[model samples]
Target: MIQIGDRLPEQEFTFITEAGKTTATSAELFGGKKVVIFALPGAFTPTCSQAHLPGFVVLADQFRQKGIELFCLSVNDAFVMRAWQQAQNADAITMLADGDGAFSQALGLAKDTGAFGGLRAQRFALVAEDGVVTELQVEAPGKFEVSSAEAMLKRV
Candidate 1:
């Protein structure tokens, strides 16, 4: 798994914006910025919808006050991610679609959930400054602890 001080791998993410579909690399997203990235298994899952995403939404401004750009990533496609964001009314967080799971696999956070789903990202959060990881919190399987927005708030 990626550790502190490690630069994030170069990968492209699909995002749906007002201009339609757009692509952004990891560097383009994290370069020269203090960014907080919270990644989850999939979009619209129970825990993700009820707690994980909502936590970030509630604490978005607090993270911004510390000059951090918050991004919520999932292994779903851009259309699903955009729809989920709209359903949640999460305007504060930037939704990132790792449609192919390439970024997650690159970070060694990819896992097979079998019957629950296919390949997906682990639940985790990381602080990146200028494209390098400053802090990383990866949750244990079926657990939610260190990766919450409230938890990140305490650290950052």
Candidate 2:
């Protein structure tokens, strides 16, 4: 898990769209902005779909009011993430799929979801300003404790 004050990890990943797939790096997302990035184990899971992602979605306008951009990530492929986003009607959040688990691995936040058949991203929330992390919260697997959008919102 990353610690507060650490520089933001490289969060590059692919975001597949109907038009075609797109590639983005963390620098592009966080540079020149105060950003809130949250990660979940996978898209369409119990806690993630019902609670975690929706919490951020419902609060997106409030966060934006605070001058923060929102991003939600999962270890699934971008196509899956995109579909999930549409299902949930999440236009306020940028859905980034870390399909290779590269970003989570680089930040040491990947977890083994054996039954789920892959390494997944541990639940986490990070506050980054221009690509530097100012606050971080990494939750234990299956526990939706600290790394919540609301918790991070209070800190901000």
Stretches of model 1 off by over 4 angstroms after superposition:
none
Sliding window of 10 residues with minimal summed lDDT for model 2:
10-19
Please tell me which predicted candidate would have the highest lDDT against the true structure. 1
Question: Candidate 1 overall Cα lDDT vs. reference?
Answer: 0.92
Q: What is the TM-score of each predicted model, taking all chains together?
A: 0.97, 0.92
User: Judged by TM-score, which candidate is best?
Assistant: 1
Q: All candidates' lDDT scores?
A: 0.92, 0.85
Clashing pairs in 1: none
> Which residue pairs collide, candidate 2?
none
Q: Please state the error at residue 49 of candidate 1 in Å.
A: 0.3
Query: CA lDDT of 29 in candidate 2?
Result: 78
lDDT of candidate 2 vs native?
0.85
Q: Which ten residues in a row have the lowest lDDT in candidate 1?
A: 11-20
